[model samples]
Target: MVDPAQILASIKTHPPSCLQATKCSSHYFSVLSGSAKHYMMFSEKICWIGFCLVGSLTHVFATRYESGVLELGIHSLVPGHSITVDDDFVICDVDIEVSFSHGYSSPGDLDVGITFDADSPVTTGLARNHSCGLFGPVHARFDDSSSNTLAVNSNTCVSDGSDVKPDGDLSLFNGHSSQGSWTLSFNPSRGYIQLQQWAVILTPCDDGAGTGDPHFKTWAGKWYDFHGACDLVFLSNPSFAHGTGLDIHIRTKARYQYSFIESAAVRIGEDILEVGEYGGYLVNGISNADLEKLDKYTVTHEKINSKQDVFTIELGAGKQIVVQSFKDLVSVKTVGASLEEYGGSMGLLGEFGSGKWLSRNGTVMSDAIAFGNEWQVLEVEPKLFQTNQFPQHPVQCTMPSTSNVGRRRLGESIAEASAEKVCGHWGDLKDQCVYDVMATGDLELAQAGAF
Candidate 1:
């Protein structure tokens, strides 16, 4: 629903150096990373969002939400650079890349530090009064999941500094809100450092769903597959703005020992949009023609060679749902502001923001089956779908007895090498991609993994 032409026109008004702003499928994010000094904008994988050079000492990056890595560049470093993260996920890891035109005589000459909100500056591995020398561009990574220790590219750099706090690395900011301003600072005591470009790669806790075989990557970045055939609540926020928030439900059908999402119904306020296989959709039990007149939402249907139907449902304000369907396989994704609004929400998608699977009784359900079954649409809840599919509310959701155990091993039918080759691009979901391809014997399902 984002108009590329309008975005391009806005970019033209900026200085010529900030000409390129890469827009991805979910939303528009502008950042720079990888081995190059310039922004490397990937088509489908990562998004290089908005870029700007406001003043000599400060650079501001306004980034929209979505899964994947976001790298924002700052050419200068004196006071610091401020990054406003509008994404839903919490900051789990942060990678800082600093490039100087020349090397420093000693690492202690320049003190690099970062601060989130009012928190104290976290020096990590970059600090002053150290015995190491800054030879070239350096990459410092702070990951909370792996270790409290900060990982740096240079062997000469010390892990801890004179002023390093106990929680110096990203562990200090882990589980904190990803929103608000993050300031990066560099204080040099000696000669001009001449920093060419410095970038921050922010990796948030992402959420996604693979339709066939029905693997779900929760908001907390945990992967689990549920093979339940029934109409279930995918995500629900009953208290969103006076109980008119988003209510999404999905219809699933059994396929061998697995299940595929047959359709999805999304309700926002008074409007309901139901999408199914093969480019079929209905708005409030009526034809799709009414979507054009709606003010709160916009829907776009792109059918490639009349084979696959990709629907992008854009709810006003940065919230969106992208549904990609190839043949009968369907995958759905919620990105940007959509995720921002669903903090502490419920359903099969798990707890929004925190990713804790909680039942209606507010009990944390660790088991995927219990979590999935806990969200089955209750009989009293309003039904959004027009047709009453089998195994509806009031009926216990049907599940495969074996639950993917001893079920044809991955790469058993499909060549292991070929499956890996096809699914390698899936990143963290690589194994899920291979499993979906092998489970359904459909190569196109792996292609839809991009959703």
Candidate 2:
């Protein structure tokens, strides 16, 4: 049972910034030209998958995975970002069917599919045996991802998946390639059988171009939409979709169709009931308790004052100030005149305040004190997001850019925020402590995010 929410989170942490990364969903959504409705419709591919049936999830990941946190402020994953998840339609195991249309609406150009090397694995890129197959240079014939011969007349075959080479006598052909053969091979060990793997063929026949449609390179790489696998074909249909911002906003039961895309309905033993109809957008069988704490995190910072009170601090690349009020306290005041008044260092409010203040090297705090009675202090410092960059905001408003011109043009004041996370060997501890404490232990705000 694949977890839909987890899949989204994984995608969010690494939101395909470059063309190569965006190849999966980006190239996948290439809608064919609207005018080519007559001549030739692209060949539809179909895949048959069972059990691994994950129900539709109503969410997508908040960020794309990256080695480090992005310097740019990340968008949140709240409501209004909902996608759809479908229910089971099968009896025993779950099946999936996905189809593709013309390749038009490209947010940007891509540089992949130009070659088929493991160097730039597109999509999830996790498929183990994704190497030269079906007709690249490493096969019994010429096996390489860059050969355009197959785009013409070609065909080939495979026998096994053993991590072994083909009969050495003909394994590496320098000039020979095919129209279709083993274009792709997962594991060379699993012997080839008609029922085992899906064989896709891409035959090129120019149908001509459309008036205003955009041009995109045919993704020479292979990707799978759950179970919707078939004799995948890239219909050089001539016409393609045309758009800068490609967003398909649909609701429940919004049926989508494509050719050759094999779709199968599936039902798990219990939890996962259906898949294939809608994109896996939601994760079923999750308890309300777990779901509540499933996402979201809290952060704690040391008070730069001496009296105990809640403080509002904005953490990010630019322009944000969140207010967090301490329980049972009202009168809030600033501890330092210029951020250097209270020992010039940051420590927590309650527990962190008790520690003795020490200055740099051998220096010590003469009258330095931690904690304070300040609850309304905004942390938009001047040195945030690099000492010279900033954004303007006026308190309320979610989508700032999506706001009215008046609100946006209010004034261009510099807003700065830098959130520092607590560090330690045990990563989970930092996550737990910050999340629990910032809950404010308030029942009314049980739903209010700690951030």
Which prediction has the highest lDDT against the true structure? 1
What's the TM for model 2? Answer: 0.15
Query: Tens digit of lDDT per residue, candidate 2, span 1-451?
Result: 3343454566567654442321222111112242111111111111121001011122122223457643211221111111121211101100111111111112221111111122232121112222232221121212223122222111222223212222111212111122111212222222111111121112111111100000111111111111111111111111111211101101111011111111111111112111111121121332121211111212233332332222222222321222222232111112111111111122111111112222323232333111111111124411111111111222211112333445423432321111113212224333322322222222222121221
Taking the tens digit of each residue's C-alpha lDDT, what string does model 1 give over 125-238? 344443235454333333333333322322244232112222245445544555555655666555333333444455565654546568776765677878888888888887
Q: Estimate the TM-score of every prediction.
A: 0.56, 0.15
Q: Please report the TM-score between candidate 1 and the true structure.
A: 0.56
Clashes of each: 9, 75
Find the 10 residues in a row with the least total lDDT in model 1: 36-45
Candidate 1 wrongly placed segments (more than 4 Å): 1-203, 241-243, 293-295, 316-318, 337-340, 403-417
lDDT of each: 0.59, 0.19
